[model samples]
Target chain A: SQQGEEDPQALSIQEGENATMNCSYKTSINNLQWYRQNSGRGLVHLILIRSNEREKHSGRLRVTLDTSKKSSSLLITASRAADTASYFCATDASRLWDDMRFGAGTRLTVKP
Target chain B: DTEVTQTPKHLVMGMTNKKSLKCEQHMGHRAMYWYKQKAKKPPELMFVYSYEKLSINESVPSRFSPECPNSSLLNLHLHALQPEDSALYLCASSLPGQGPSGNTIYFGEGSWLTVV
Candidate 1:
């Protein structure tokens, strides 16, 4: 499977705390993207890091990619209750085709 | 607010019924996709259409037929579906190419399908 694997299937944290999720994939990728999906909702693109880039940050989210390790991580700073959602890491394995595969995702809960 | 839009936010159909889930995007993205997501699971790629052409099928079952009428519109024609086929159908679009902007896929709110 081209899908990535995410650690900590579920995580619980309080507001003002930081929540981190890690992902590992098996194949070479052009880029890795992180998405957030609320329950029964559509996914929202969070950030994207290329294989050449090590780290990228967007607003309260930080994403790191290590192609050598075939792993990536996402960190949400100052988590809020509204931050509760499932975070997924997607890998674009084929450069010619849009064959993007997704990880199982990490369910995050932030308490007020 | 996502630029991609999907119709029939919720659908309930029988095994013998035939239905079509509609998706549209005005962003002028050359690539469109359909994804099936089960409860608590990640979205599975069902089909990909680039430049209004079927580029990848992902070996999807025949019961799920994907159609791209134009660059801005995509549809999934469902027929004789099993109960297991019930899932959240997501529609997405992206610019066709590499790089951050090209790889970034914009998804619709999704349609909830329930096969009875």
Candidate 2:
């Protein structure tokens, strides 16, 4: 079973625009992580935000966590055509220390 | 090395054929995982090995068997698979134990399997 669900299943935007993807989970989580996957390859870890943290940034990527609302969002500033890929949100539930469940994912296409 | 490597990048097998998927990581990660992903779907957890011990099975079918020969290697043996079982097999690894930090998991380029 998937613990998280991403909104806006698909999004398309022009280069230089910003892309934002949201995720909502059901249970309390110790942490939430965002990942990116190219067309036929495995996923790559993007960023991780702890439950206690509100927001974090890496390069042009920004991630925000809202534990009160059980939701998180990932924002890509100055999106480029290379940013086109599928993004997933994985949650490590507070109850389970070893298992992490991934969401359906958001497919973002950056048009050049 | 800090990467996970998987062999036989693509495989085609018959229902009665028996084959195996191999994964190796040199990062010394104590936890390894196997995940199955169908087209356009999120990868599903299949098995997990921690410290060279089987920790989680995820209720996977009997036809699939997982092996951890050492801390640096994991293998999944497949047999009697149906056509519906065709999908990408992904291997991943992360630091041992739980934490809100420094436990970022890394994945390898998945093995594309086609069952006929």
Best candidate, DockQ: 2
lDDT of 1 by residue, B9-40 (tens): 99999999999999999987999999999999
Error of 2 at B89 (Å): 0.6
Question: Number of the top candidate by TM-score?
Answer: 2
How well docked is model 1, in DockQ terms?
0.61
Whole-model lDDT for model 2 versus the true structure? 0.92
Interface CA root-mean-square deviation for model 1: 2.1
Q: Is the docking of candidate 2 incorrect, acceptable, medium or high quality?
A: medium
Over B29-80, each residue of candidate 2 has an lDDT whose tens digit, in order, gives: 9999999998878888888898998988889999999999999999999999
Cα lDDT for residue A66, candidate 2: 98
What is the DockQ score of candidate 2, to 2 decimals? 0.66
Clashing pairs in 1: none
In angstroms, give how far residue B111 of model 2 lies from its true place: 0.4
